[model samples]
Target: MTRHEETGAALLSVLLLVAVMAVIAATALDRLTLATRIAGSAATVDQGRAYAFAAEQIALRRVGELVRRDPAKLTLAGDWLGRDFTLPLPGGTGRARLADANNCFNLNSLAAETAPGRLSQRSGAIAQFGELMVLLGIDRGEALGIAGAAADWIDSDGNDGPLGAEDGVYRSMQTSYLPANRKMADPSELRAVRGVTPKIYARLRPWICVLPVADPVRLNVNTLAPEQAPLIAMLMPGQIAIGDARAALAARPAGGYGSSVRFWEASSLARLDPGDIAEQTGVTSRWLALTVNVTMGDGFLTAESLIDANGGAPAAGQAAPAIVRRDWGESD
Candidate 1:
């Protein structure tokens, strides 16, 4: 080949090499930028979580202070770190709220014999649960059976009713799934109980929850949605329509039920079976689930807090308060 041609070819090869190197450099830069962005996002999420935790600590401190001042005023709120708060809970994003631990049932208290055998433990509350089950399209017998199974699952025993899933029954239904004994650790555990179909669970999810083994069963009238009051009313024998319950409640002025005691003692309860009413109502100290909607500037964070309400002080700057569950909820 001629010298000139050879020189031209060498130059071409060098140009090609330069192009390749340029491509590699560009790709590396893009990757570095992407990684940095990812790291920044992670840090932001971490910061938000940290802030949430800080807010929880502030909430607990406020609860202690409020209770010390007036235990009956547990549902009051105060401002902290630029956020407004409350209990029975408060109202802001990145804020924590407390529910009276006394407002729910300790799954541990459920027993085939001693449990009121009522749906909601009020008067005809079980009948209301049965109604909801029917409303949700489950058969009456199936609905009651599902409740029985749920009761059996959380009742600290292995005894199985005809419809309940003891270990043997659960093992027979599905090869991969097993059953649990003793009390449930969380309300979600109910999904694992036999006879509780997914659809029924979906219907009950918003209204029901599991409390600590040490807690007691008490319905919170203030927190209950319209759908739940019927069940509470149904545990008694008198017929209770959802409309009737809502109307009776709406008739009462603000400050939902006077004291928790007065809440249950209303004249509407006179029609309910006293024995069943006694067993199913009232709260305990160890567990609570509160649905709090908070407004932070222009944004909103609606959160449900499952708390362990005790007398001890929380550590500084941290609300590591006993959390059975803390999860994101949709805005109302």
Candidate 2:
């Protein structure tokens, strides 16, 4: 071949080699940049989680201290569980808010219905929840349906009652799912039941909680102020108006009722059935919910926990109180 042609061929080969090298360099640079970003994000998330776990320990210890001091004073009116504080962490921040779990109605109580169709009985939580909905201005039939459906999801039997939706009804749906046939796993599960629309669930969410146990929703009157009296009014909705409930709560003695007897005597709730009142009311709190939020750089973490301080404190100079239950809660 001619000298010029050979030179041209060598130059072409060098140019092709350079192009290939450039492509590989560009690809490696992109991958390295992506890996760096991923590592940074992971570090931030790890820090946030560490902060959340630390906050949880603090909350549990606070509850333990309260139980040790005086169980009766464990109500929301006290300073222990009501304190809201922020912690300054290294290159981040974390905060926690404490709320009285008993302040809300226990949705698990609906699963405790003994008589399937006797939903109107004042002794059952189904009846009380139904009445609460009615008092909230919900249609009577819809309220009854919501309560019955809540129970139907729990009861072992597959029978579809007047207001309940059983497996047959659920299976026939377009989504084609089956009934839980057990206690609800979360309050959000209520939206899966019949007649429990998003709107209704939203209205009820603020006032209801899914306690770990299948027990009735008991109101701790001492922790409730006039603003929170609607929970007390929900007990006998047909008889008590929201204003009257507030009045009774406002009339509570300073520092709150000292005991169940004092609570009954100080409020019109004394007029309720002795048995029903005794079964569904208390003067102190057992459950506490804690929400902790942690932020580290671009990462954020939130955790919720339900703490059951059922084990009362020991006599003075004894060991610390025991926690009956502690479980994680759904995300906010």
Candidate 3:
């Protein structure tokens, strides 16, 4: 071969080798970048989870202290109930809020018994919820439909509620899902029940809650505020008007109404015909809702928990606050 041909061939081979090395180098760099991102993402998520846990612990401590300090003085107006906590985390920030959950209408109140989904023959909660709808000015038929459907969803019995549908109605839908046949896990579940339009649910959302405890919960009269007057009106039915409810609510002592008797005596409720008023309302709070929001890097995580102040049955020689429920959710 000619000398020029030999040299050119050698040059071409070297060029090809360099190109291959460059390609390999580029791929390795790309993989390294991707792996670094994955590791960083994983670390951020873990940090978020840790922040959430810390927030829960803080809430538990605060709530436990409040409940233990003075059971009688616990009320919705307590500074701790509506306060917000912002914590600085290593890589992000965590925020938490504790709210008075017991003062609201518990959707689980509609359930008759604590066992999954058994309808009660005598639970007044369903009637109270129906009355709430009436006061909200919802169409009577639609309101009844929502209450009845909610009852069927929670009750083990196949009995139909007035204007409510049975499993048959749910099964006929295009999606074809069965009735929960259990207590609602969240107030959002109401949206799934028939006749609960978004608008209706929105109106009711502020006043209602779905507690993990299936037993009926009495409204906290001491914590009840003027904005919550509608609930009181419903509680007393014909006996208490909304203004009277607010009047009674405002008259409560700073610490609280102190007891059902004190609550009855301080406001217009003083004229409640004098019998079993505690059955409908009380000054004590049983449950509180805590929410934690953590922002780590570009991602977000939110956790909600229900703290039972009544200190649920604990093992012998132990005093512990009940964390009734914990749920991961998104900000609305």
lDDT of 2 at 82: 56
For residues 1-332, could you state the per-residue lDDT of candidate 1 as single tens digits? 99999999999999999999999999999999999977866665554555565556665555446445434333323422123354222222444545554443333444323444322222133344455566555778887776667655655456675456666767677565655555566667877877777777776665554554423355545444454455455444245555655554454435445544555455654454346455554322334444555543444455566655543333211233355667765521
Candidates, ranked, lDDT = 3, 2, 1
Per-residue lDDT value at 193 in model 1: 75
Q: Each candidate: how many clashes?
A: 20, 0, 0
TM-score of each: 0.67, 0.85, 0.84
User: Across residues 204-290, which tens digit of lDDT does each residue of candidate 2 receive?
Assistant: 888878776666787777667688777877776577677777876787776766766666565565565544555566766677778
Scored against the true structure, residue 240 in model 2 reaches a CA lDDT of 68
Which residue segments of model 3 deviate by more than 4 Å? Answer: 1-35, 76-78, 114-117, 121-123, 274-277, 314-318
* After superposition, candidate 2 runs with Cα above 4 Å error: 1-16, 77-83, 113-123, 267-274, 311-332
Point out where model 1 deviates above 4 Å. 72-137, 155-159, 173-175, 214-216, 221-227, 237-248, 251-265, 283-304, 312-332
Per TM-score, the best of the predicted structures is 2
Candidate 1: give its CA RMSD in angstroms. Answer: 7.1
Instruction: Kindly indicate the candidate among 1 and 2 with the higher TM-score.
Output: 2
Give the alpha carbon lDDT tens digit for every residue of 1-332 in model 3. 99999999999999999999999999999999999999988887777878888888888887778766765557654577667888878767788998878787788777767444455533466667777887888876777678878877777777776666777888888977777777787888888888788899998888888887676657777666778888877765456778887888888777677678777776587777646536767766777788898998798888888887765743211355667788887623
